[model samples]
Target chain A: MPAVVVGPGVASGASPVVSVRQVGFGYDGRPVLKRVSFDVGAGDFVGVVGPNGSGKSTLIDLIDGILQPQQGEVLIAGRATREYRRRDLAREVALVPQSFALDFDLSVREVVEMGAYCRARSGEVRGDAEWTLARLGIAELIERRFTELSGGERQLVVLAQALMQRAGLLLLDEPASALDVSHQLRLFDLLRDLNADGLTVICILHDLNLALHYFSKLLVLSDGELAAFGPPEEVLTPETVEAVYGVRAYMHRHAGRTYLTYSPRLRGERKGRIHVVCGGGTGAGLMRELVDAGWEVSAGVLNALDTDEEAGRELGLRMVVEAPFSPVGDETHTENVALMRTADLVILTDVPVSLGNARNVEAVCTAAREGVRVWAAEGVLAADLAGATGALVESGVELHADTAAMLAALTARDGSQRPA
Target chain B: MIRLGRTSVWPGIVLTAGVFVVCLLMSLAFGPASLPLARIWHLVTAGPVAGDLDSAIFWQIRLPRALLACLVGAELAVAGVIMQDLFLNPLTDPYVTGVSSGAALGATLGIVLHVAQFPWMTVLALAGGFATLGIVWMAARRRGRVNIFILLLAGVTVSYLASAVVTFLMIKAGDDMHAIVYWLMGSFSGRGWTEVELALLAVPLMLIPLFRTREMDILLQGEKRALELGVEVERTKRLLLVTAGVLTAIAVSVSGIIGFVGLVVPHIVRLLVGPGHRGLLPVSLLFGAAMLNVADLMSRTLLMPNEIPVGVVTTFVGAPLFVYLLRRGKA
Candidate 1:
């Protein structure tokens, strides 16, 4: 199915199979893989992470000898990698790469079988295969066509093939990227088992939480350079997270364990707002401010149940309520007039004062004439109400634009906190 | 990750042997000889003893031609397999990089000017191929290292130039057109001990060194993975390329640019056996030999009075099979 399937079972109890020393590689004279060097112990499981385009994949290729370093040499089992015979190298080292489609339609099993091609005639190919698939939890997927499988299933199958080689050293490129949460954790668990069983593994990851949880060694890559390399706790500091993510953050200790969280600053400047004569239902917004500013509020000249009337009810404001369903009918006008006379301030809403409600408008004028303060909406409706009432020419009655100005007028001293 | 599965390595082995026997019988029956089957068998068995014209014709003429077919087929097919894996391209063969064209131009130069007496025609052809590959490689390289796309481009450009040069040389050779064209077309006609002896001398020598690389599994998958496990990537690649190129050059130098066997034979055998360099290399070699042998037999018999070139016979037969394979989703 693969143009040819070589079946060589991975050698057992082999010595360290690969090594790199002071390696520096670049492209077009710009360094993509710098003079970064590290050793993968016989069964080492190293996890790599970085920002986008941070050269993690390239490091894997370089470590495996796909690309040679300009400045350093690569060795396997104490011998120069260049010197290990081909069959010998294959027997000792195996790679399980990220899954890719071929120009040909080989089955999952067929594709996996190609890994054994070098050791085609050697014994235990089936056993190795069964073990590998079982370890990856994809034993039943062997018969499924590779193209038809889900991304997670395909990843496991590919990993199974790489593991079937039973090589001492495995180079994996994001082996669990497409898997679900449990599957990703399971994949790491299997990788841990393989490492424990003495197969050196190198994997790349992006999630700091998972990387911290699963891997013992964390190689932090930034801009194709090694930012830090050590244990997760040693390398993953609050300062490091801030440096990489380019934000202000803190390492918080909760319940005796440390975690990273951010204190977000304003993203952009605030746009200011002011409200005009918002009586009746209009001044619900003003009630919101009184609540936000920790202030008390009261409004009058409503028959009952106006828009501002309901807001005042919700806010538990002290309100002068008129009679229901009727405006300036006898007793309600007397009550409103008495209330306006006692109030220190009166605001004219856009409510029209016809013959039936002429007395209500007179209360506002009377209040203004008595030097009680008054404010009006800036538009024609509020102007008409103010003119009908004969409030000040410009002295006693003030006109404001939108809600922000109206609220500011109510709570002018309180301006420190607002959304950006 | 390509997993190695249980393979029917024996089927390919059996089929290869079967093809050899059937081809030998087919060959004895062909070539204007009106002998009975029993008589043909008797005639072949009755000799190891030679001297008479009939025996000489059978042993020296036909026997060597058949053997040459086998060797050339093996050489080209194996060479194709190696080249394909090296390039990571299914469509590529040994001559995808114009190794054959370069060899053809060199051979044409050799025959036209009678330079065969000096540096040796096979040697000249090999040099021409390696030199052109070098030039193309250098041209493909820009600033420093060679990329895969650049190499492929260089191969296509060099192939075109080499074809043009060969055509010019053929025109300049004048009245010697018959010999030149026939040879260019390619055939095992009139080939006897010298051709077999020459192929035996060159092609097998290259295969011996290549066979030592039993770890070709590592080489074929990818060089880096192999190196991480302790394979010297550059050295292995160099050795493989040189060995494969030399075998291909020898086959071309002797057989006169047999096309597609290197491409088609490997693909067919790979579909049958798999990509293990061990099985792939050997199966491709044997299967290619059988394919060419059959094609050679057809060339001689199909147009008996006007012999067809073995190259023509092969392309004619191989191209359709190749198409069929692609359609079958086995390409």
Candidate 2:
């Protein structure tokens, strides 16, 4: 993996565009944001992500000067935002709100022209309005009613309006929330292009993958406080994600980009340790089920590049591996038996018998003989397990049709170990 | 290459101005004693067509009353546009601040108590209008921002309260109900040079909102968006509400509660030229003036000598058009 540099800000050389100092704010005496502070440099493209009611939108509002912080200060361009006149601050910062419902109809050109209001001496700013509409590539929509445009088109026009203000910092509140996939990409591309032109952008994003893919820096807000703020690769670890969002996450790298997969965390602690013995992709599903169900899981005596091994490593499970196309060596078999010896239960997944690996069924039978509880998948007994499957069941191994039945049997036996 | 034509606003302006002038001329000529267009022109230019009746009716009565209607219509329409933009609600009108109801209450009290005459009654009505607005303003304002929902609710509450008071006074007046009803229904029946002058005085107040046209446009996007765009949202809203209240109060004092012009005229003009107030304001001024002047003419001629109050005629014409607009789902 390429090294991701972690720092105070992305554009470290450039002066900060927005500097929030221990800002605390709330509505109707109930605090929504508490002592949140972060610095956004002049050319930074930062994405703010959090679960619902996490103050992502409140942070944007404070930075945009729509709401004053009850405690601390927000400074734009080295001046306190509260001290700057509204028009002066407007020339420094512009916000493209999520969506606006216009009560009266205004043409796209007219709407965009409003961005130049603070600069214009009168209502007319013909040159600036025309230039902005053309620049945003929506010159064709200049005469169309704003209410009649598609969601993406309307968002683009609103972005055009904000750009026309010529503000140094642009704040967007979930700009892509209502857009289709294609429109979402189009909006991000537009923002990227604008950022390339030296505009600093801070956007609140609900989609974590988009934030990881697009932003140089991520600000993770959880329940109105800053959980983490750093480079995406540094801040978006599985542990941090699970801690802040309460979901189990797995980060994967493909095509030189990182993707995060998430699932609801099981709401309890581990009941006992379990060893899963299988190969040829049969063990992958059982390993995931065991891990999510709060069992300390280990899987092994398999070829190095097996799909199960990959899943084990992704879910951070302990495993023993041997080289592919080779027989299970004595060293690997010994390691698998030692793992089974410590486990409270051993599970054998249905795997077809092969010359390279028939010892997996033997390992389960050996563990059952040693008084370790052994559970065999229903189909394993019918499979041609080199004649070891019959011995495995004859050794007093339990049989389960599926993962659900296995989990139910384990839960019943480990009732005393279950979390309250 | 796509060519940009000059705005398309000028053509609408020209068309509105033409309609206004034609309506004014027709209103001046048609009345209880209908005069020929040529004769009316002569009366204005050549002074009375061999009779004092034509001269008296032309200069002193019809012309002032017609001009007063034009001015009141323009003021009310401009006020409506400002209120609609400030609230960002199409249903909002000039009287949303309870100005008309307050004026009605004052006019009713004056009739029942006999405490004031025409000019004094106008003063009392203006006082009542501002006082009621002040209460609604206080009730709705919080942390220096006017909560639009609260403002609307307070306006409705105060309007109901004022109407209840007016109803109580109307019951006390008993036999004087006809006189109070005529005033309440709103009319330009006896308006003269003074009423026209009063409306002219209020006409300049339209410039307050006109100067803030850009702010109003930004406000139409929604208050929070406007504030983010660097507009002093609270200040702009307060200025617009006060200006609209003052204009509506003045119009109501002179012509009673002339309904619909303040509510419907701006909407019609908006449909015609779009909602950019730079164009909408001026065009609405013309269209509003024309509509009221024509309605006043209808009031005099449709029932002849019986003189249906101009307010009744405006409602008769405006309500159907408003309903049509509602059915069309365009307003």
Candidate 3:
């Protein structure tokens, strides 16, 4: 979709466009990036994501040759970055900064032409500027004043300015952070088209979802260290997200695409532990809500690949997991019972009644008989075995219609027990 | 020539050059002893005869003053553009860096020391201006890179300190008060070919910004963005600050602290041709010369023998025009 082919000559096909080797940078003795090493290969689209103050912006500056690493080196095209002159490095790498505010009245055409400041003045400079603007689908903005454009339009114009440099490697620092959703998509799409034409891009962004959706590779930074690097799916695992961001994340596949949704790990004062007897996909939501509500939740008798088992694992909960689609064997049943015996209360979700998971109900009844409070929803599982259900009823087990009603009952019971 | 909107910057530059030519001729021809246009043309054609009074006034008096005005005007305007862009503040002027105030202090000292003669005052002012620049430079340097924000604050602080000393000297000197006051008021009245030659020294420095027009334009977005875009920002900034400081020193040394032209000419040229430095720098240079020439002409002619200060005429003409431009909403 680009109007012109703007890229470096493919001569350095053997070396990565960027190489940061054991680079460590600091400001005033405060480290910003510590022993970070990564190589961005030719024609790669890389997205850099990190929490605030994780050296994402500093990393870009180092790679752009604006900041030198105190300990290690950055090599562009297998040459030491410090060796290249500023103009020569610019010809090899272009950066579209996060934001620019021009106070003077300057036309977009004039602003874009400034991108060729280091290049010798030729007639092709104007043609190149026009083509770059056209490639970004903003040819009409050439005559508009840069100060008068919307934030989205201004970012696109600035991107056009960087493209006018015709460099192979392009770095953007949160270029889409100020844009609306539609504009963000439009900007990424333009970046994609440009990348398809062999423009190597490394963008630093805060939106992890957008990073996963667009970039081929993701470099995650945490506390001034490279936390993970590789393909998005391989690198942005739930465990990595929790470790780096102190939050629980659920990876979901919907409509043939993978994405993640996050929940904050609100670690408040210690609440009493509760054991959940759930199977299939029914208890994932309940487990998350209970964890968020300051309860230490444990789940049991779940098959290894079950949705609830994955959710519990992602939440870092202690769970008794069994093999997939297998009957609750004696070992896991005893483990589930021991888990319930340690919990202050046991809650059973309305999972489908099946012979394979029939022992989960019996495990709850056994815990109740042994002097632990047991709670269950009146569902197919409770009704399947009348003898077990009758024994549970006789042992003072509380039954609610659904999760909300059951949660309300639990909240009321806690409030009565511990009044403020 | 660059195009902004539907119009090309060529027309603006051409028109300003045309106006500068007219201002040049008028400033040379019309004064207290006004020469007829035909007679002025004949004198120019005759070319600097040694013994005639009218010819002496035309060649020896009016011509050099006009040339000095044009040179100093161009220097200030170029310095203004550099300072405004370098600081990324529209309120920035050539004197904002404290160089002019330093020059004024040196000129005041020259008056007080009874060395208020032609070259002594000029030399002392240049020394004072450069010394102030060195002081501000050291204050802003951090790890070999200049911080413009810190530089601005330091310049302002130094400017106030120098101004306080100038005020004290003005209050102390009884006999030399009028001489110091007249020099401070800024007139091109008795500046002959010597001052004109001294002002001409800054002409090459003025052209330095023209070559870096593109870099100056890119710097409008700020230094970080300029660096990312591949500009040698620290080097460019060092060169530009020194250029602006030197130009300001020379201009202020020749003409004592002429205001408004340095502050307002760049803005007007920017409003006319947009802020592309390819257009902004050259157009502002020509327009600044023209505006100051006309202001100097009006100062000599408006009240005739009693002549108003050229700075007052420039402020009187410039202040209203600047406000009008601001109200037009494009600035």
Candidate 4:
């Protein structure tokens, strides 16, 4: 029988549910996890996130008593895992594996009932398999053959099996890796409900955004060591993400939930500066491309709440922002011109011309006349250019159909100017 | 919550038991000297009448042979289920690891060297079986893990080597070639009470695996998952392999390599009742017993005074049925 708890809330100073004290593990003399230590309190939904082969799965195995650490011990419920009997540990920790294929044609109920093997007597599964399957919203799959279910359905059934064990602590290894978006949300919702009912869940999530959305705490592993462990808001900061994953990430909050978006950093030395004259969501992709190619990027005359402004701010690019729904003011235009004057190249994006920001086209023409190399992106002139297209074309502005063509032109120009 | 009633396996069990009795009766009644069913039934209920040919044949020859067939069939089929479940491969059998070829080589050596006596042959066969299994294991181990594909390849290689040696020994036994060749073909002819007793020894040994059905069920989900579920995977594997090896050794000693009964009966039972060992094991035992008894009867009566080898009959019946099952399962 499972030990009954008071409720979902963990009292202050409650004993730790899981404790890893200086544990180290290796395979065939090569280390996979090194001296990892952390504590998980009761009723905590903790997510373990790391790059592939960074020892996240190995840490789960250690806590579940599947793999013993070579250097230090792992304690569950204040006792060493090695000190517990196999069935006793199983009753306390239940693991829903990533995926498992069955050779035999066993019914889903038969597979779920196997979880009760530790508690039941010989040839008997103590728990009601149907009840558990129903609780997971898979009662219809009870009599279905396990091998015939879809991947997402199989994962849900596996979760049902784990629940049948009635374990207080649940360990899931990439439970949402094979699920569709809707199914992933369903599974996380189920997990949250279970956690609300007093289950301590430690899930290894490969999707960082999903982890941020569902977990209260995050344990970040990098190169076999613990990089950070705290509330998701604290542990998933820009610096820690870059250090651990070698990528730049932005954490956004909407409706009181955190979301993470990341972009790969450029390699090698910095390229020359480029000013992008774009707005209304057209210049966001161009700005990211410039940043990734090692160029110092600046965008301007964007309305305050434009998507391009948000992308610029997220990527930390220099920008001249105007008030939303207003014409471009002289102050913003002057700021944009000053930014363009220092640039080695200026880019005109395909954003539609409107009365609110038609001065952006004039700014680009002035920059081109002043000897700044201007590259007019293909779709910009095709859209509404506010009758400034012909003058800009005659002003010695280069034309390119896409970002790839413009990048090639820039690289060729850079190569030609190296001697100077 | 929907309360889907649990499907009981009792009805299937009772139905198979009824079929088993019919097969038993059929095996008792048909032979070269065809006995009447009424007279055979009377002989079964009453003691053998003196100086009666029907009673004499039923008690001494037909009855013992059928009983031996049933016992050996149960042993081999249960061994197949254990081996298949252990490896998690559907095509595996009691002899997949070269145990039968090893037994054949041992029996041939016993015959060529004039040590073909009762207990010596059995002991030699067992020694040979374990030795072949050891060689296969050693050949398949890599970096401290047993790769099952390598093990299958090694088993095939060792089987060929053992069969070659057995053929060479038979060639050397020119005068005793008929005895060695007939034994290699595998027959239940002239088998009597002693062979039945020898086969009965495997029943308790067979129970060891039956008692481990729960662990075997977990093991069917791969070894790593079984470990996480708190099964002592290594220990369970070792115990099941040793028991299966011994069971195969015993069956080979008495029956001289009955081919395809072990391989086919379990698959047939699995198709009939689903593959939970709680149902699969008992059904395989009964179905294996009935199938082999029916095969032996056909082997004796099909040619009428010729008596083909029971192994040959089983191969002819089992191979085609296995193919049908494979295609049907795929479809």
**Judged by TM-score, which candidate is best?**
2
Top candidate by DockQ: 2
Evaluate model 4: give its TM-score.
0.89
Q: State the DockQ, from 0 to 1, for candidate 1.
A: 0.27
Q: State the DockQ of every prediction.
A: 0.27, 0.71, 0.59, 0.55
Please give, for residues A67-164, the per-residue lDDT of candidate 2 as tens digits.
88999999998898889888998899999897777756677878888888766665457677777777777778987878889888999999989998
Report the lDDT tens digits of candidate 1 across residue range A1-420. 001111211234654455567667788798876666555566556778877777888777766556667777777677765565655666666666754444333457655655664455544466666656777778787766666788777777767666655567777887777779988887888888878887787789877777776776777777766677667766777667656655434454557655654423221221322211234565676555544444434566555666777666654556666666665566755666566665545555555545545565566656666776666555524435434545444346665565566566765444544332
Error of 2 at B189 (Å): 0.8
Best by lDDT: 3
Compare candidates 1 and 4 on TM-score and give the better one: 4
| Per-model lDDT | 0.66, 0.84, 0.86, 0.84
Candidate 3 chain A lDDT trough over 10 residues, lowest sum: A1-10
Q: How far is each candidate from the true structure, as Cα RMSD in Å?
A: 12.9, 3.7, 5.4, 5.1
- Residue B25 of model 2: what lDDT? 92
- List, residue by residue over A1-420, the lDDT tens digit for candidate 4: 111112232336988889898999999999998888778888999999989999999999999998889999999999999998878888889999987878777889889988887667644654488888888888899888898999889999988878877888999999999889999999999999999999999999988888777888888899899888777777777777777888777776679877777767733346778999888788888788778767889989888888999989888888999998788999999999999999988999887887777888889989989999898887877787476676778777888887668877777877898899
Q: What does candidate 1 score on TM?
A: 0.67
Q: Candidate 3 residues A1-420, lDDT tens each? A: 111112332335567889889999999999998988888888899999889999999999999999989989999989988998888888899998876878877879888888886665634575777788888888998878888899999999999888877789999999999999999999999998999999999999988888999998888899889888778888787777877887767787779878888877744444889899887777888888888767899999899989889888877789998888898999999999999999988998888757788888888888888889888888744546334454557766778787777778777877887875
Give candidate 4's error at residue B307 in angstroms. 1.4
Query: What are the TM-scores, per candidate, against the unseen true structure?
Result: 0.67, 0.92, 0.88, 0.89
Give the fraction of reference interface contacts each candidate recovers: 0.19, 0.81, 0.74, 0.60
Docking class of 2: medium
